[model samples]
Target chain A: MAKKFLQRLGLKDKLLAIIVPLLVLAAWQGAVSQKLCSELILTPPLTLLNTLLELAQSGDLTLNILASLKRVMIGFLLGGTSGFVIGILMALSPFLNRIFGPLIKALQQVPEFAWMPLIIMFLGIDEFAKYFFVAIGAFYPMVLNTYQGVSGVPEKYHELARVFDYKSFRYLFKVIIPSALPSIITGIRLSLGLSWMFVVGAELFGSDSGVGYLMTWGRAVFQIDLVMAGLILVGVIGFAMNFLLERAEKQFLLWREPVDGRPA
Target chain B: MSNNKGTLEIRNLSKSFIVDNSPLQILNNINLTVTSGSFVSIVGSSGCGKTTLLRIILGLENHYDGEALMDGKQIVGPGTNRGIVFQDHRLLPWLTVGENVAFGLDKLNRKEKKLLVDEHLQLVGLIGFESVYPSQLSGGMAQRVAIARALANKPEMLLLDEPLGALDALTRMYMQKELERLWQLEKITMIMVTHDIEEAIYLSDKVVIMSSRPGIIKQIIDVSSSRPRDRASSEFMQIKAEILEEFHLGTEYTFAYAI
Candidate 1:
């Protein structure tokens, strides 16, 4: 009876997910309003919402968020395409892998920020440096995932390819790529996430625009509220993008999943 | 050197593998000939290299000691003349059933490819299941799709590596009959490797039994019993006992072991 009642309750995942965040917000508000914590440290949720409104009224939030998003998109595409092509080439030919694999592996081991000094030194604190840094950040995950996906195609499928006498290009497109698509999509998701992170890091080095610059400017002005607002925006937008992409990925690879019964 | 388009000749084929740094022979100088449009089944226990022999004929294993000739040409690597149905369905999971069937027909025009795909799906009794993924299909249905994929290629010989070995008893029996009907309908050369001796006897023109551990053909028994032959008949039991004697599983041998 209890189980049936629980089933009938029909608590949707979204409803359940919102509960914890709401509780945290309520707790933070209680701490601030009760004067149990420093006001500057634990800004109330309402205060953050008001700060968002003020920033929107000033048009700063919109501009800075747009700037960061633009960098993330451009960098993701640049990194994703090159990584995909190079990954396929390396996976297909051992000679190419032998020549370039070691150097790429070594380069990837170096952190994304480690290249910033040299990048900024050559290109200066401009959009170019930010793009380059974010692109490099996105590159490693995409390349590694794509390489794994292509190379790890099952031997059974390869036998089918051989049995059918497929040519090299046809095999690559029809079998290898389709087989590796799930992994490639995983790589893309991870790369987009990393690029988002790197864009902010790049902007923080020195920039006049972007949410990273807003946070830095807020710090310069000693206004902790602005910094909090910037942090909240970054977290929410990043999370929302990731959540949407995951849904899209699932929809795109529907054929990869098994359906229950034959459709009427 | 004879130009028998559908005939296959295996000349003293031998294969060995380096297992744990020691050379272990798998196939021991195997020789067989399959005439055009005939069904030949190879039956043996596991580790007997029965599958290995099928692989050799399928042009999968290249390092074997001898030659496999299909028609007048040497069977070197995988070619268009032979279609293989692996033990597993091995269908591309990302593709729909129709796409999997038409995978090899990329060179053909769209209309021709669609027609062929439809015809083969119909042949395998899966006409309405064209849009579903392989994962959605049951084991038997997926196996049928695999067979359809192979048949769509129009190969001279169909190589089966225990295709129905994974099915339940009822499905296995049904598929055995379906396979026989398919063979009769297609009238193409078929070489199947199976563990079910009854399956071998019911479908093939001849049943070739192999002994395990460096596998060799111990005997080739021609099952000239009529189409859809009775499984419970005394003649069938006699042949079954004869095969059991070769495997040392006959009643007399069992009684001897018990004593």
Candidate 2:
């Protein structure tokens, strides 16, 4: 009886999630009508919606979205690939840890924004610079997470592998990689989110394309609607990407019981 | 080498680990001998280093003194000749039961390996669940898969460290019977470490009881009862009582003895 009650409670909880967003939108519209803030500081919902439609009709919006997506794809590919390789290497070798571990740790301490001015100087604000920044942003977390995952394989598992005479690359691919997969996938998801965030930051620094650049253009021309539209689009896309990755993570790691099912 | 496959003799075995800036003695001067196709059980309290001794024998713990001789040859590292079943079924979570069982038999052709895995799964009474992964298995079922995996190697000796320790009472009882049958069928030299006195007595031809903290063999009881020992019989109860007395259980001195 209690199980059924809890299940119904969970269903009601999900309904509240749906209701809460609608409530927030209603509150925003109410605040706009009440004129709680100057239009410059907080653009009303209808104005932002109208701006989004106008931009879509102009075709520049899609182009900007495409450009940003392209940068994210390229950067994520490069960064994620290298991070995975290096992470595995570091996990496998204590010697590599001694040499590169400290260096990577130091690099991680600097914010993505801190790299902006230096990267802009080196690559001259080109597409390469944007892609490079996005890639670098993705790399550290991916590498670090993979290293932790691979190295964190319980000693017992390794011993089992050894007892089975699994001391080769085949063993690594079959046992170690599968064992480390949850962590690796977590790293990839994190890297994916940062790829988008860093690409936006790259665009913020005077790129000629992307939603970020378009937002910049809007702000310069005093088109508050366009800026709001751009922010909303960035948010939706970021949320969508994260949502998709989360689903992928669930599918990939189906072996692990969903967190809710298992006891803490 | 070809004829004398299952003989194992350990000489002056010792192991220690550094703990809090001091060398903690785990195993001290352990030695044993097992002829071909014999069953031995090592029973001790938790943290008595029984598992450590098993690890040393399996070559999983190499930072130990003394040599393990198989047919008078020095055992250096884990070899196919010694199969080990861990307490937790270390079956790869991602691999299906068949694949996990087939894991160590990578040298065999795909067909042969499949056949062998299927055979062993049947031997362990997990025949139809070959396609299932570890996550789908109950604790006892997973442990059975671990046993099947170990048996797939067709090793001369099987080293099981509390292989059924995770199972509930009923399952453990059933598994003990199954293990004994499997042992009779395979004729592999079996060495198991368990704390359950009944289990040790029920399954083993000989039981080596060890003392706690800086572990050492306290007593070696020879279970002289013949095949299919009667657990409910007076003989079995008498043996159980004797073993319990040796461990100082049901005695006024139990606490002091344990210390």
Candidate 3:
């Protein structure tokens, strides 16, 4: 009986969510038919859909998708790993925090795209430059999140672990890391989003291939359809990445739920 | 480490907390001994340093003067031999019930660790909840899991800092009975710090009544009742009255209040 009520509540929420998006899409299609705005300013939804279909049929789309994905994966791994290590070190020792904290914070203040010119100058407008930008974009969030996660662990849990004779690595991995994971996940989500933005900006600067480069190519040739396609693809891919991260979070962080069967 | 069996002897134990510019004295000239496998409950008013005393005993606080000797060896820090359950369950939110129980068993092999966790979960009547997380548990249930986790270490002494203070009255009663059963079956020492006077009288072999402010042992009363104490017994009420008077709470406050 209770399960039925909860399922009904869930269905209601799902229905409510679908309603707005569907209405927006319909309004978009109407605006295109009526020529509500200049075609240059606002491409029709059907035209955008048709362009997406054309890209899909051409097979160039796959290469572009793969290029963006590879860059994100590499940059994400490098940035996330380094950030995690440095964050944990900073959390464990005040001396390390004092030495590196100011420098990292200063660097973080500059947006990831702001470093693109310097990176392009140093790395010479190659793939490495793009990867480096994505990495920097991904790095700050990971480190800051990790530091907060580790340092924010309750003193009570530390006391409990000590009483249990958990010292050294045993105490760190078993207690400290697990206690700090929710914050770590939040950081990861933020960095992942930033990486998408950085990869697009990198492609815009001077890449021969990738989604961002394709969008720039379309813009140079006055192929607004292709640009629209690239924009849609980026939005979809970013959304998918975020969705996957949310699912993983639900699976991994079950213990954080409240007593009333709601997510904490 | 010296060996003297399971005697817990505290010699001239004094603890103070630094507040603002001055030191605030908590436990002053505290001296107490708890025999092995004995159930000792310390009852006191609010801010009486009951929790502080427990923290010192558990080796979580080290700024105190004097010594806490477990079996003649001075306690320098927390040890596996002394396990604690705080008023809150304090179960790690990222771990499942079985994993939380196995948190202290980092040294044990996987198979042995699983067995120990399972055994303690069963001991607490939480056998089928092995896969469930702490967030899915009730207040009483979560506290039981905390108890199970502490017991999985097989500690020589279990320090409970008001383990049942957060539970409802009915659940607290149920947990009290369950605790008494576990204490008798496991036969490990228990030192509980609680504000519940009736709970102290009902569960403890000896009740140590403590005074407020600069916390000090006001009286130590030995309950001569047989095991599985009847709450309705006159002897139980009399001891409860005595302990209440020691803290100036009066016998009228002994009537069971919802936890």
How does chain A of every candidate compare to the true chain A by TM-score?
Answer: 0.89, 0.89, 0.89
**lDDT (Cα, tens digit) per residue for candidate 2, span A74-96:** 99999999999899999999999
CAPRI tier of model 2: acceptable
Per-residue lDDT of B1-259 in model 2, one digit per residue for the tens?
Answer: 2335778888888789999999999888888887888899999899889998888778777788887887688777898989988888888877888999999998899999989998999988898998876878888888888889988988988999999998899999999998999899998889999999989989988898888778887888899898798777767777777789877775655334443
Over 4 Å off, model 1: A1-14, A35-42, A94-105, A257-264, B1-4, B20-22, B252-259
Give Cα distance to truth, residue A177, candidate 1, Å: 1.7
User: Per-residue lDDT of A1-264 in model 1, one digit per residue for the tens?
Assistant: 755664578966667578769989999999899999988877788998999999999998899999999999999889988899899888888999998799999998897778988998899988877888899988888998999999999898888888788768888898999899999999999999999999989888899999999999988998888889889988998899899989999998987755555321
**Model 2's DockQ score:** 0.43
DockQ of each: 0.40, 0.43, 0.52
Measured with C-alpha atoms, the lDDT of residue B86 in candidate 1 is: 85
Which parts of model 3 have CA positions greater than 4 angstroms off? Answer: A1-43, A259-264, B1-4, B251-259
Q: Return the top candidate by lDDT.
A: 1
Between candidates 1 and 2, which one is better according to DockQ?
2
Best by TM-score: 1
Clashing residue pairs in candidate 2 are none
> Model 2 residue B4 lDDT?
58
Clash-forming residue pairs, model 1? none
Model 2 segments more than 4 A misplaced = A1-11, A23-44, A258-264, B1-3, B18-25, B212-214, B248-259
Give per-residue CA lDDT, model 1, range B45-160, as digits (tens). 89999999988888888888887898867878988788888888888888999999998888899999999999999999999999998878888999999999989988888999
